[model samples]
Target chain A: MKRNGITIGLIILLIGTAVTAAGIGAMHISPQQVIAILLKQINIHIPVTYDEGMANVLWQIRLPRVIAAILIGSGLAVAGAAMQGLFRNPMADPTLIGISFGASFFAVLTIVVLSSLPFMNGALIPKYYLLNVTTFAGACFTSFVVFRLSKTGGRSLITTLLLSGLAINALCRALTDLVTYVANDEQLRSATYWTMGSLGGVTWSSVWALLPFILVPIILLPRLAKSLNVFALGEQEAAYLGVKVKRLKAVIVVLTTLLVGASVAIAGVIGFVGLIVPHMLRSITGSDHRSLLPNCALLGATLLTMADVVSRTIIAPAELPIGIVTAVIGTPIFVVLLVKQKKQLRLMS
Target chain B: MIITAQNISYSVGQKPILHNLSFAMHPGEVTVVLGPNGAGKSTLLRILSGEQAPSSGTILLNDKSIQTFSLTQLARCRAVLSQQYMLNLPFCCEEIVMMGRYPHFNNHPAAIDRDIVQQCMQEMQVAQFTGRLYQTLSGGEQQRVQMARVLAQLREANAGDVTGKLLLLDEPTASLDCLHQQACLQKARDLAQHGYTVAVILHDLNLAAQFADKIILLKNGQLVKEGSMREVLQPDCIADAYEMEVEVWQHPDYNFPVLVPAEHKVRSILKTSNKNNIHEYNSRSFVKG
Candidate 1:
C-alpha cells in the first residue's frame, strides 16, 4: 500500500513538474495561459487566440525542445538503468559500452567528410537523413565491437567489459579529434557544439526520425523488468532461474545502443542524464526494474524539461546549451547522492 | 525419478575442470556433492542447473534429454543458489525474494505470488528483513535471504502440481555461520523429505555427514566415490580428496560422523602430564584404529 502511494505520488509530482516547467520559460507565460494555449491548439473552444508570438514560442520553439528533452532524457536514463543492471555495477552507464563516443565520432565524420562528398552534396539527398544513418550505423558498430571484445568463452566478464569500454571510448575519441583537427572552422564549431550537446537543433522532423528507435526500446525494455530483477542476483543464478543470460545481455546491449544512439544523433552527447537520473530514482524506487524503469522514465523527463527551461531563461536572450545546464545542476546533486549513499552504508554497517 | 550425467567433461581455457564426470541424483534423497576448492563443485552445479553446457556427454532428466526442454521448463524443474550475488542497485528484501516468481509470473505476480514470497521469508526466518535493503543485511542474513529467494522459486515452480522440484545449492553455507548453516542444511533436508529432489555442493564434510542422505565425493573433477554418507565420507577417501589427515568418529548424540583433525587432537594431548599423556595417546590411537 505504501509502495502504491509512493508510485502515485511520484506520478503526480512528475506531471505537475513538467507542466510548471513548460509554463516558466523565457516568455513568462502564466500557467493558465499555457493551459489555454494548449487547449486552443487542440481545437477546444477557448477564449484565447493562441497569441501568434506565444503560439510560435510554445509550439515551434519550446514544445519540441520540451518533447525532445523528455524523450532523450528518458531514453538515456533507462538505458543507464538497464546497463547498470546488465553489468551489475552501480557506476556503469550507457557510455560504458562506448556508444556515445561512437556516435560522436560518426556524427563528426558525417558533418566534416560525408557532407562534402560530391554526390552527397547534390540536391537529391537530405542532409539530416544521411547524418542520422551514418551516426546510428557507427554507434551500432562500435557497441558490437566492444561487446565482442569483452566476451571470453561466450561469457562477458564485468571487469573485461569495463576495460573494453574504456579502450573503445579512447579510440573513438582519438578518431573524432583527428576528424575535427582536419575540418574547416564552421565544421569544427558544429562538431564541438554537438559534442557538448544541445536540443536547440531539435525539430519536429528530428523527433519523428528518432521516434521508432527511442520509443520501441522504451516500450519493450519494461517487459524485461522481471528478467532484469532475476539478473541482479548474478548471471549464474539468473541462468539457473531459466534466464538466457547471454541472450538477455545481447538484447539489452543492442537496445541500449539503439536508445543512446538515437539520443546522441538527436541531442548530441548529453552527459549526466544517463548517469544521474537512474541513480537518483534507484534510491527512491528500491531497485525493482518494474518500478524503477517507469519512475526513472518520468523523473528523467521531468529533470530534462526543467533543465531545458533553465538553459533557455538563465541568461535571458543568449541560451546556454541544455547539456551545460544539466551538468551544472546534476553535479552537485550527484555528489550529494554519493555522500548520502556512503552515509547510508556506514549506518547500515 | 533419476537425473543422470554421463561422461561429462568441461574445461576452462587450457585447463580441464571436469573430466568424464558421471553421477545420478534420485528423488526423495539428499545428494550432496563433496569436494575441496577447485574440485569443480561449482562447475558441476552449473551444468546440472543447465546454466552451462558440458563439453561432452549429456544430462538426462528423468530419462529425457535436458537439452530438449525449454528454459522455462527447465526452470520449473530446478532452482539453483550460487555462492556470490551482488546487485548494483539496492533491492528491498521482499523485492529480491519476489524475483523468484519470474518464471511463474508469465505476466505479473498475483496474490498467490505475494503469499508464497511471504511464506518463503517466514520459513527462512527472513520475514523481519522483508522491508530492509538486501545490501544492508549481514553476510549470514543475506545468505538466508538468498535461500528464501530460492525457496520462493521452488514454491512458484510447484504452484500447481508440486512435482519435479529440484533444489541445487552450490556452497550455500560457505559464508554462513554455524546457526544459519544448520538452518540451510535443515531446509534442504526438509524439502527433500517433502518429495523435492535436492542436490547440494557442500565443502564441510561434517555438515554433509549430518544432512546428506547420500554423498558423491569428487577429486580432480572426477567422481572419486559415491554412496550413502557412511560409505562415501570414510576418513581415507576424504584424506585422499583433500590431502589432509583427519579422523572421523560417530557423534555421541546423533551417531553421525564427526571429523576432527588428527594433529590438533594430538597437540592437545601432548600438553597434558607426561605420564598420563602416553596412556591418553595410546587410547586415542586405539580409538583411531
Candidate 2:
C-alpha cells in the first residue's frame, strides 16, 4: 500500500498529461471540449456540449494520437524495465542494444529488402500501413532470436543476452545498409522517416491494433514484478529462491518483445523513454518490480504525452517530429541521470 | 532425508571440474567445503543447490531425484546464498531482504511474511540498515544483509522437518568482518544443531575449524579429505589440499583445531636459499601479510 502511493501519483500525472495533450495540435480545443468529446465517444455522455468539428478533431484526429502516445510511452518504459531486470544491468534499454531498431529494421526489410528480391512482389504491405507492419515484424523477430540465444546450460545467461543482442544489432544494421544501397529515393525517404522515429500517422486502427500490446504489458508485466525482483539476485539466486527462472526468462522475453515491438511499430522507434523512465523510477520507487513496473508505465505515458504535446505546439501549425522532441528532451535528462547513477553503475557492474 | 551425491563428475568442454566426487550429507551436521580457488567448491555447491546438474552423476534428495522436486518444493526444503550478487538497482535494504520471502508469498505476501523478514534482519543485525539503499551500504554490511535474506528463506522451510530443511552458502562471510563472519557461521551452526542440514563453502580454514562439524577438503576437483573437522584437518591433509603447511592445534577457548599457516617456514626456507641475496625477494610484496 505504501509503495502504491508512487504508482498512484504517476497515474494521476498521466491522466492530467493525457487530457492536456488531447487539447494540443493545430486545431485548438478547450480542455472541457476535449473531455466532453472523449467522454461521449466512450458512451459516458457529458452534459456539456461542443461543436461537431471539435468532435472530429478530438475523437478522430487528436484522440487516436494521444492514446497511441500513452500506449507507446508506457509500453516502451515497461519493456525497458523488463530488459534491464532480465539482464540485471541498469544500463540495459531497448534502443541501446538495438531491440527498438530491430523493429525498424524489419520495417526497412519489408519496405526495402523484401520488396527488392525477384518474385518478392512490389509491396510487402499496402503503402499506407507499410511502416507499422514492417516495424512490428522486425521487433518481434529480432527479440525472439536474441532471447533464444540467451540460453546456456538450460538457463538464460545475461552474457548470452548481451552477446546475442550485439550480434542481432550488427546483422540488422548490415541488412538495413544493404537495403539502403538498393532503395529508390521514395523508399529511402520513408525508410529514413521510420528510422528517425515519429508519433505521426497514428490512425484509430493503429490505436486499436496496438491495444493488445499496450494492454498485455501493462497487465502482465506487473504480475512478473516479483519474479523479476528475484531475478535481480542473479539467475541462479532466483532459482534458489524458488523462482521458475527458465519460465520467467521466457515470459520476460515474450513480454519485452511484445511491448517494445508494438511501441516501436506505433511510434516508429522512439528512444530513451524506455531507458530513462525506468532508471529514474527505480531511483524513486526502489526497483521493486511490483511498484517500479506500473510506475514506469505511468511516468512513461505522462512524459511522452507531454513530449508529443510540446512537439505539436512548440512550433504551433508546423510540427516538430515527436521522436525529435523526446530525443532532445530525453538525451540531456539521460546524461544527467547517468552522471547521478554513475556510482551505482560502477558498483554493480 | 539426506542428500546423496554419488559419482558426481562435472566438466566444461574438455576440462573436468569435479571428478568422481562422492559424498552423503547426513541430517544433523554442518558440512563445510574448503579448497583453493577453481577447485570446484562453487561448482559443487551449485550442483547440490540444483542450480546445475552434475555432468555424469545423480543427486538424490530424500531418495528422490533432485529434478523430481518442483522448484516450489525444492525451495521449501533448501536455500542457497552464493558468493556474489551483482545488483545495480538502488533497492532499499528492506526490499532486498523481502525478496527472500518471494517463494513463500504464494499469490501475495501474507501478513506473517513481514514478521519473518524483520526477525531475520534482526538476527543478521541488519535491522538498523533496513532503510538505506543496499548500494550505499558497506560491502560487509551488504553481505550481512544478503545473509539475512538467505536466513529468511530458510526460516520459511518447515522447522519440524529437520532432515528436509537444508541451507547452502558459498563464501557467505568472504566480505564480512571477523565479528560478522563469526556471527553468520554461528547462526548456521546453531541451525545445524537444531537438526537442519547445513553446507557451506568457505575459504577461511580457521572459521571452518571453529564452526564446521564436518569438513570436506577438495583439491583439483577431487575430494582429498572428508570427516569430522579434527579428523580431516590434519597437517598433512591441509598441506596437500591447500599447498601450504599449517600447524594444527586445539583452540584453548573453543577446543576446535586451529590452522596456523606456517608463515615462518616460508620465510625460513627463503632465508636459507638466499641469505646474502635476499634483498630482492624480501622487498617484493609476496612476503608481507
Candidate 3:
C-alpha cells in the first residue's frame, strides 16, 4: 500500500516536472499553455493564446527532448537496478562496469570512420541504424567479457568484478580517445558533444528509435522482480529456491545491454544517473525490486528532466553539459555512500 | 516422500567429491550426515536437493526421477538451507522470509502466504524482528531468519498432507549460539515428528547422537556407515572417519550417546633447540588433561 502511494506520487511529480520544463526555454510558455497546445494537437481548441513560433518550438524541439530525457533516464536506472541485483552488489552500475564506454567507443567509430568510407554513403542502411546496431553489439560484447572474466569456478567475486570494470573502462576510454584524435573538425565537434551527453540533438526520429529499447526493458524487468528478490539470497540459494540462475543472469545481461546501449547511442555517456537513482529509491522502497523498479522509472525520469532543465537555464544562452551537473552532484553522494558501504562490509565480516 | 539415491557419484573436473553413495531419506525421521572437513557431505546434500546432478547415477523423489520436476515444482516440495547466504540488501526480516513463498505465488503474495510467513517467523522466534533490516542483525539472528524462510517454503505441507516434503539443512546451526543450536536441532526433530523428512549436515557428533534418528557417516567421499545412532556413532567408526581418537559414553539424563575426544594417551616430547633451550610439545592426542 505504501509502495503504491509512492508510485502515484512519483508519477504526479514526473508529469509536473515535464510540463513545467517544457515551458522554461526560449519562448517561455506557461503550464496552462503547454496543456492547451497539447490538446490542440488532438483537435481540441482552447481559448489560450499561442503563436506559430512557440508551437513549433514546443512541438518539435522541447517535447522530444523531454520525452527522450525520460526514456533515457528510466532506461539507465532500470538497467542499473537489475545489474546491481544480479551481481548482488550495490556498487554495480552499467556505466561503472564500462558498458557505456563500450557503446561510446563503437558509436564514435561509426561517426568518424564508418561514415567517411566511400561505399558507406551508397549503402542501403542509414548511418543511424548502423551506429545503433554496432553500439548494441559493443555493449553486449563488453558485458559478457566482464562477466566471463570475473567468474571463477561458477561464482563471480565482487572484487574481481570491480577490478575488471576498471580495466575495461580504461581500455575503452583510451580507444575512444584514439578515435577522437584522428577525427576531422566536424566529426570532432559531434564526438566531443556526445561524450558530454546532451538531449539537445534529440528529435522525433531519435525518440522513436529509443522507445522499443527503453520501453521493452522497463515493462519486462519488473516481471522478474520476484525472482530478483529470491536472487538476493545468493545465486546458488536462488537456484535452490527454484529460480533458474543461468536463465535469470542471461536475461538481465541481455536486457541491461539493450537499455544501456540505446541510451548511450542516443544521448552519449550519461554517468551516475543509473547508479544514483536506484540507490536513492532502494533506501525508500527497501530493495524490493517490485517497488524499486517502477519507482526508479518514475523518479529517474523526473530527476533527469529536472537536471536537463537546470543545464539549459543555469548558464543562460550558453548551455552546460547535463553530464557535468550530474557528476558534480553525484560524486559527493557516491563517495559518501562508498564510505558507508565500506563500514557496512566491515561490520558484516 | 522417500528420496532414494542409486549409486550417486559426483566429480568436479578431474577431482571426485562423492563416490557411489546410496541412501534413502524416509519421512518421519531426522537423517544426519556427519563427516570431517572435505568429506563430501555438502555435495551429497546438493545432489539430493537437485542443485547438482550426479556425474553418474540418479535420484528419485516420491518414486519419480528428480529431473522430471520443474524448478518451481521442486521448490514447493523441497527446501534447502545452505551454509553461506549472500544477502547484503537492506530487506526487512519479514520480506526475507516472504521470499520463501516466491514459488507458491505470482506477482503479489496471497493472505495465506503472509500468514505462513508470520507463523514461521514466530516458530523461529524472529517475529519481533520482522521489520528490522536483515543486514543489521547478528549472524545467529540472520541464520534464524533464514530458517524461517525455508520453513515458510514448505509450510504448504504443514497442515493436512505432509507427504512429499523434504528439508535439507547444511550446517544450519554453525553460526548459532549453544542454546540456539540445540533449539534448532529440536525444531528439526519437531518437523520430523510432523511427517517432514529432514536431512541435516552436522559437525557435532553429540548433537547428531541426540537428534538424528538415522545417521550416515562419510569418510573420503564414501559412506563409512549408515544406520541408527548407536550403530553409526560408535567410537571406531567416528575415529576412522575423522582420524582422531574418541570414546562414546551414555548420556546421564538422555538415551543418546555422548562423544568425548580421548585425551589420556597424550605424550609430551621435549627437544633441545639450536639455542640450547628445551622445548616441550604435546602430541595430537592432547585435547585436555
Return the top candidate by TM-score.
3
Candidate 2 B-chain TM-score: 0.88
Please list the residue runs of candidate 2 whose C-alpha ends up more than 4 Å from where it truly belongs after superposition: A42-49, A112-134, A144-181, A184-186, A344-349, B157-163, B251-253, B263-289
Model 3 interface CAPRI class? medium
- Model 1, residue A263: distance off in Å is 1.3
TM-score of chain A of each: 0.88, 0.85, 0.95
Ranking by lDDT: 3, 2, 1
Give the alpha carbon lDDT tens digit for every residue of A241-311 in model 2: 78888799788877887787777666667888888998888767688888788888889889888888887
* TM-score list, all predictions: 0.90, 0.89, 0.94
Which of the predicted structures, 1 or 3, would earn the higher TM-score when compared with the native? 3
Question: Per TM-score, what order, best first?
Answer: 3, 1, 2
lDDT (10s digit) by residue, model 3, range A188-259: 987877677777778888888888889999999999998898898988789878999999999999999999
Higher-DockQ candidate among 1 and 3? Answer: 3
Clashes of each: 0, 2, 0
Better model by TM-score: candidate 1 vs candidate 2: 1
Docking class for model 2 is medium
Q: When superposed on Cα atoms, how far off is each prediction in RMSD? A: 4.2, 6.1, 5.6
* lDDT for residue A80 in candidate 2, whole number 0-100: 91
- Please give the lDDT score at residue B79 for candidate 3: 95
